[model samples]
Target: MKFLFIAQRKLVILRNQDFKDINPERQIEITRHFGPIHIHPTSGECQGGSPSSR
Candidate 1:
C-alpha cells in the first residue's frame, strides 16, 4: 500500500508492501503529529469537503 503525506506544501511518499504488519492505530498516531492532513485517492483528486486537522 501507499501513503502520501503533504506537509508545508511538500509531498512525501510512503510505501509498504506488507500492510498487515503495520497497526492502523499506530499509523494514525504517527500521522497526527504532522498537523492537518488531506487524504487523497491514488488518482490524486481531493474529492469533496475540507482537509482534516489533527
Candidate 2:
C-alpha cells in the first residue's frame, strides 16, 4: 500500500512498508515513533556551497 506523508511542507510517497498488516491501534502507536522528515528545497542548482545557503 502507498502512504502519503507530509514532510517539510512537501508531499512524499511511501510504499510497501507492510502497513496494512498491522492493527489500527498499533498503527497509531507506530506512527508516533516516526520523526520529523526533512526534505531539501527544490529550487535552482547549487553551486560550490551548500544547497541550504541558496
Candidate 3:
C-alpha cells in the first residue's frame, strides 16, 4: 500500500451559503454535483454505496 499527503496552505470560506440551512437530502443532492461525499472509514457500515443518506 502507498500513502500520500499534501499540506494545504490555503482555504476558501463561503459565507451565507444556503447549503448550511438545507435538509440532508437537498444538501446531498447539491454536493453530488461537485463530487462524491466522503464517509469516514470508522463510521461503520452503510447499507447503500455511501452514508450520504440516512
Query: Among these predicted structures, which one has the highest lDDT?
Result: 3
Clashing pairs in 2: none
Q: Rate the local accuracy (lDDT) of all candidates.
A: 0.53, 0.50, 0.58
What value does the lDDT take at residue 19 in candidate 2? Answer: 76
Candidate 1 off by > 4 Å:
1-9, 13-20, 41-54
**Candidate 3 regions with alpha-carbon error over 4 angstroms:** 1-12, 42-54
> Across residues 24-44, which tens digit of lDDT does each residue of candidate 1 receive?
555556667876655765535
Candidate closer to the true structure by lDDT (higher is better), 1 or 2? 1
- lDDT agreement of model 3 with the native: 0.58
Evaluated at residue 46, the lDDT of candidate 1 is: 31
Question: For residues 1-54, what per-residue lDDT tens digits would candidate 2 score against the true structure?
Answer: 223346445555568688776764565556556653233676544334442332
TM-score, candidate 3, is: 0.45
The C-alpha RMSD of each candidate to the native structure, in angstroms, is 8.8, 15.1, 8.2
**Local accuracy of candidate 3 as per-residue lDDT tens digits, 1-54:** 112222253333457787655766676787667566777878775334455545
Regions more than 4 Å wrong, model 2: 1-7, 10-12, 35-54
Per-residue error (Å), model 2, residue 13: 3.6
